[model samples]
Target: MKNLILLLVTLLFIAGCTSNKTEFKISNNGVEAQVLQLKNHQISYTVKKDGHVIIDTSLIGIVVNEKSLGSNSKIRLSERFSEEFDYSMFGGKNTAYHKTNISKFEIKEKDGFTWFLEFLVSAEGVAYRYIVPGTGTQDVKGELSSFRFPNNTKVWYFERNNDWKLKSHAGEWLCSDISQMPAISKMGPVQGLTLTCEMPAGGYALVAEAALYNYSGMRLEAIGDNTFKANFAEGEKGFEIEGDILTPWRCILLADDLNSLVNNTLVPSLNPKPDGRLFADMSWIKPGKAAWYWWSGKFSTFEAEKRTVDNAEKLGFEYTMVDEGWERWSNKWETITELCNYAKNKNVGIFLWKHSNQLNFPENGYALMAGFLDSLKQTGAVGVKVDFMNGETKSLIDFDEALLKLAAERKLMVNFHGCQQSSGEYRTYPNEVSREGIRGVELNNMKEGPLSASHNAALPFTRYVTGHADYTPLAFTAPGETTWAHQLATLVCYYSPFQCIAENPEYLLKTQKIQPAINFINEVPSVWDETFVLPQSKIGELAILARRKGNDWYLGVLSAGEKKQLQVNCNFLKEGNYSAEIFSDDILAEPVPLEGLNPRANLTKRNTAIPFKKEVIICDKNNNLMLNIAANGGAVIWFKAREK
Candidate 1:
């Protein structure tokens, strides 16, 4: 009888423990997150695709003023909501992208400090944020958000190249298996905006952030065995959080295939809709190619810029950037107006540049910027490229947003340079088309700063995972560092709404040797309706991208290490006849190879331009074509579907 009583007691104890924990399931499009909310205890979660776990039990919480948020907290309330984004980002990838997601959880913690730990799960991935409500102010001492992967997970990431360490969120793409993973403290800070993980559970995930506002930028730091914790920028001190605080949405972009990973719109979907009342006339914003003199080793002058506008018109480009040196022109504003007028006749828009610091003075910053922007708009300029804002403190973020709003007020587009990673800012403010958080092509001006073929190959998978980077691609100033064909391929592979081409006027418009490449550049569209990362692509080795604008499909294949044959198939096309225009490295006109002695240098210096060849062919849905690419070379194929 005594034994039976004891057994009943034991069973009740087990029941009590189970009842204390509640599992709230939020799922969509095969991606699901099960958040286990412990009553008055620490909270944790597990993310899964179908039934397989992509993220093991991971902790998610934030501490305010040294008080634990998730731990020793009560779930005072919970609710559900749905959101839909039907409008388009005027200057982004898709013309009109539709999104729907379900929201779960809004917990209340100590002293009416009602903070809702909300999660939005969409088909692309999961995004969550902490919405803390209060009256006065709050100090966020720490963020305990972390992603704990399986012991054998492989992470494809990059080291922080700038002084921001990982804060800059820009560098050469890299990958690491178990042996190369650095220790927690020694790893400094790694990329947080977008970091890819080859899950041990048979899928892929990209860790990133979205909708950043009034907060310091985030960088991930190795915290444990195959785990990374969210670390805020170190210099972001005393950032006052007043009223209701909405933290940035931490995003997990998931996919079963490389194509899905590359095309997921979770990052942008998390951002709030653009202010309809502010930007009622979205037609003013346009996305197209541009010609710039920066990478041409030439400075812009009044007459010189007119010549560039002519080059832009000749190449069928929609815009030309006067760049930094135009201010040095005597009677700068008048010269700018004259250049803008000249370009206006040829239907080419003009872009101007400004030092970010000049717009930061508290005394007359707003007045100066407003006056200048108004005057510049009067001069027929279309946009401004604000440069040298290399930090991510909350103050800097505030200024950046202010600039975008100011620029937008005058119907001007803004491109930020020396900036932090694009945390889906373009989604909210589409007028800010692109940013140079990336180490772009202009670095070739340095004797030792030329980019390698492998680095360019890795770009689409790594750096571009965030958003449009103003890489200013297809520069021929440092020829033979990569084949001109390779440079041409970048114009297609890279994503920039501004699509700024930095090739000099002479070679791009006059030289017949590279006319095929130039023609290919002029034909491809800047944005696409569809993008497919071909199965042949291997990160850091090769990039095979198939993109479609209207009914025409363009396939760009870039080879990194050595001379090799890359094939293209018509499977990506619909069932119909298509005429394909192929531009490739000229087999009969390869660069003259010289005996190389320097072991450190990757490519031998060449003084002459590398030649290319173009071919026209008819293909069907089942056709396959194989073409040889020289070392550090590439090819482009534009397939136009025939009329029925």
Candidate 2:
């Protein structure tokens, strides 16, 4: 009788412990996630795709004012609701995400704060954020969000803004055991803000942040074995905000293949919609190629400025950017107005450059910018490129947003250089065109070798996935271990709304040798309506991309320093015949061994040009195109749909 009583007591104890914890299941399509609301304000979640666990119950919470929300703290759910909606984007992959599910819960903390927890699951990935209510202003101490994956996961980590160690974004995408992962450091060897994980359980996951406004950018620091914690910029003590605070959305892009990572719209979807009035008449905002004087060793002289404008007209470019030296005149308006009139006469717009510090004065800062821009608008200046904002502090982030709005009000376009990567800002402010966050072609002056064909191959999947990267491609001075065809393909491979032509105008436009390649660059569009990934594209090896603008299709293939052959079937075309124009590496052209050498030696004067040759093929029901790319070479095909 005593043994039976003890057995009943043990069974009752197991039931009590289980009842304290509650599990919530949310799913969309093939991806499903389960979140557990545990005792003491602690929470955990596990994400699965097609019944295979991708994220294994990772801890998620925040730390505020020295109080730990992920640890021992009493809390209770006040309300729960689920919402579904679809919204349009001004500039993104598509019109909408089709369907989105938002699950929200209001939890009241016993210690005087109420937190609104939200989990948003979509076809692309899962996102979540925390909103603390009832506040005039508050300082967030830190965040307690973490990702604890299963053992033996592989990751493609790009060290963020570590120009000190990793020059020109050149480093290994180290694939190693998750347990051996090192913590991310701000000023040490190399650390990353973006973590792309190849899960051990049959799928892929990308850990990144979205909707970064009025908050410091987030980077992952490995805290333990197979675990990473959220770390913000170190100069500030968390974010300072007014009224109720809605933090940036932390997203996990889960997918089965590389193509999804390129096409996922989660980051832009998290951002607020564009101000309808700002975009109601977007005809003023034009995205096109421009000529720049910086890379050509030209300064603020009439001859240099006129040279760039002449080249802009020669190459059929839409704008010419006068870099920093234009500000040398004490009466800046005189030189700027004269140059603007010169560019206007040549039918090319003007883009000016400014230092961030020169525009930071409290009294005359914004007012001076307004007056300066107002004067330039009369001379037909279209945009301005602001540079040297080196950190992601709250003040800087807010300043960036303010500048975009101010530029928009003045009917001027904006591009941020030396700034953080695009966090869907273009969606909110359509006037904001491009940013130079990635290590771009300009780094060739400082580093060598790694910034070659392999680096170009990795960008479309890693950096371009974030947003518009102002790489300022198409350099004719030094091709850098790549053929002219490979450089031509970069015009199509790298997507920038505001692309700058970093070539010498005298060499690229005046020379007759490369006019065939230059002719194609003159016609390529800066933005696309649709994009497709081709097969056998491996990072650091090769990149094949297909993009659509209007009714035409453009295919670009970039190859590293290895002879390769690929047979491409035109089956992706509509059920009709098409005409294909192929620009590939000339097998018969002299193989110039230019790798690891000073790039300036190969330049030609205005009279001498190196000509290139390509083939034209007609694709029908019975044709499969064969591409033979040489070492450090590339190919591009322009296909036009034809009637049968």
lDDT of 2 by residue, 1-644 (tens): 43234223323322232333767777888878776766534566677778876776566667665555544434344444544445543332435463567777665556655677788777788888887764677667667676767788886665434463222233334345677676443544224445677777755787877888877776666655466666666523566677766778888887776677777777776788778876677787888889887875745665788888998998899998888788786567877788888888888988999888767543655677666667767766889998887766667777788788778877888988877666777778878878877767765444432256777887777667757778888754566567777777888888777888877666776656566767678888888877777767876678888777776678888788687898776655556667788888787766544333234333331211122467777785356789888777788888877865
lDDT of 2 at 454: 75
Span of ten consecutive residues with least summed lDDT in model 1: 593-602
Off by over 4 Å in 1: 1-20, 38-40, 90-101, 110-112, 160-168, 178-187, 235-238, 362-365, 479-481, 592-610
**For model 1, how does the per-residue alpha-carbon lDDT over 1-644 read when each residue is reduced to its tens digit?**
43234224323322343334767788887878877765535566778898877776666787666565775555633677777655565322475354546555666565655578888787788878887776788777656677767767777776544464453445656677622454422444445556778877767788988988888777675644566666666522435677777899888888887777777777776777788876888787899988887666456667777888898999999998778888788988888998898899999999899888888753555777787789889999999998887777676787788888889989999888878778878878889878887766765554545677887888787778768888888755464456767777887788888888866765677765666556667878887777888888877789988888888888887678888887777798877888998878875685534233122222434544455578899997799998889888888888988988
Q: Which pairs of residues collide in model 1?
A: none
Candidate 2 local Cα displacement, residue 466, angstroms: 2.5
